[model samples]
Target: MEVKSSPYYYSLALLFILNLIGTDSLWASPYFQSGDSIESRREVIEFDESLIEAYQADEAYNYFKNVREESAWEKFKHWLSLQWNRFLEWLLSGISEGNFWNYMALVLKILLILGLGLLIAWLFNKYYVVSQKSPPADQSELNLSEDERLIQQKDLSTLIEEAESEGNYRLASRYLFLNILKHLKDYNFIEYQFQKTNTDYKSEITQQDIRSDFSYASRFYEFVWYGDFKLGVTDFKAAKMRFENLIRNIHNSKTHG
Candidate 1:
């Protein structure tokens, strides 16, 4: 083959063009170049080592480290304190908001407390004072109304007439009982005394029939008088018959004895 057309000559021509272009110049191009070292360009920061420890020891910084977990009771107390604070806030908010209901509720609570105090004071005065005072031994010295206190001292017939006239059957029953006691005293069956109870006089009677009659009279009189029973004319008549029969029986016994 001719030298101009030979493949060896073409290869040599291509190598010669590559040598002129140069490796250094091709690598130095912007596309192939690298940036400056990252370490060399880095900013240098300097700080005191002691400052790290100082910051760690600070109360604000070390708060979580020093804190201990709360016990159940302490946790409950904390929760309760928070609830109380919230309640106080709510209560005050009502007033601050000018709520009429909240003001009325406060007033109602005050009135209720005052009412409770008054009730307790009244009970104490009524029950305590009554319990502390000793009852008088004598019937004449009893804590009674003026009329009741002088009942036994008055004439039986007059008292009975007055009680019946006034429609005070209870007072009439009391007069009847006093008359029975007076008859018992006159017959020497019993000694009447202002200090003595009806039971005391009943115990003195040796005769069974008289004692039974006296018992019935006493219970009837007590029911009408001390029991504070109000009686109509019909009821008074029925009760009066019992006392009259007892008085007649007592007279019959005294006459025979």
Candidate 2:
């Protein structure tokens, strides 16, 4: 036998549904009330509009976005790189276009540059090296040979007269140089030594005019005495005058002092 459902059971089911709905409302009430008050009390912050505009307007403000300035070396490298690239491009274009004459011209230009460089190096070596090399031992008169002791032993005046009598002006010029050196040594102007250079003697001289005169005379002597060239009578006369002037200056300094 199947029993029919009662109205009283339906009323209890409806009451249970209503009670669940009211409980949910009770649990949500505090949250909604607090949220309303929090929203009502909240304040809106006002910023200075000029500060934002000024910062955005300043170009230097974006420090991290700045491009670095290239140094001189870096700029040169970049320029060289660009030139090399352009040259390669031109070379490729010429080759692709079958410009045989242009290619030959370029090769000739490079060879010409290399030849010029070699010529410059050869010229520098020939003249500079020859000037610095010690002259032949037989070139100096009296076999003085840069020996301070031998130079001091000989009478340079008598040697100069003999060299001039033979018309060996080169030998005469050498004697003149030795004469001035001897005078300086005898007067205690310079501490003479075989190992010392003319530059060393120049530094030892204290008088300004004497030092200047010595400098001119020393350079001229090195060219005439130590060089592998013939000194004519006219050249010897000029060199003799320079040496005599230096000697006179030395004498004047001693007399005045």
Candidate 3:
């Protein structure tokens, strides 16, 4: 005959059965059902292993890059330290050897270099790139003999008349300017220096009205002569009028004075 089990044993057995069932469910894969075969599980395990390997490779590469950067920085620091030590040693040795005069000479050489640089900069500013386009104060006439100078000092009025007769209005306008300057020179209103710019003469003319007339004539001369503008008969007439005005003003000032 079969023996009957105790109630406590029977309850314990039921609980163990339920716990096993719950644990099986808890341990099941979320991607695949618990019922999947071993082959499917093997493929998923291989995929996880490949992912881990790839992650390990990326970590190794990053570690290698960090090591290389740190090594480069250390090398640069070492080189700089070596250079600094060499410089300190050289400086100390030179000082200890009583070569003070040599050091002084070096300092003097540096100062000379600095002075040269400053002089070059000054030359660039003064000559290469003039701030104001005014001509140099030393530029006037070319050197010539006294006899040649006498021959060249023909009267401006006669030159103008000859130029007009030749139908060279451009040349005549130039002579008209020279005549005004000659009159100015004779009256001692302004020094007729070859190096003197028109602005210089303008400054010398203390009279406002006279300076105004000179400015007009000087501007006309600069434009037609230096500007490369083709001077026609009409331009010549205007230039002559301005020159005449300048001459008359100079004469009037002289007479009044």
The estimated TM-scores of all candidates read 0.40, 0.55, 0.40
Off by over 4 Å in 1: 1-154, 255-257
Q: Estimate the overall C-alpha local distance difference test score of candidate 1.
A: 0.73
Model 2 reaches what TM-score against the true structure?
0.55
In lDDT terms, how accurate is model 3?
0.68
**Top-lDDT candidate index:** 2
Q: Compared with the true structure, what per-residue lDDT tens digits does model 1 show for residues 1-257?
A: 66468898889999988887888788778666587466756898999889998998788886566667999999999999999998667545567667899888767766877999999999986555544444344452224343334444647778778888988776677777777877777677787667777889899988898899899888776665554456788988887888778777777875423
* Candidate 3: residue pairs that collide: none
Per-prediction tally of clashes: 0, 0, 0
Q: Which scores greater on lDDT, model 1 or model 2?
A: 2
**Would you list the clashing residue pairs of candidate 1?**
none
The true-versus-predicted C-alpha distance at residue 84 of model 2, in Å, is 11
Q: What are the lDDT scores of the predictions, listed in order?
A: 0.73, 0.78, 0.68
Residues 1-257, model 3: lDDT tens digits: 99889999999999999999988887784755666777765743236788777887885556545333458888899999999998666544555566878678657766877999999999886543543343223222222122123323756678677777777775566567667777777677887677677789888877888778888887766555444446787778777887887888787775322
TM-score between candidate 1 and the true structure = 0.40
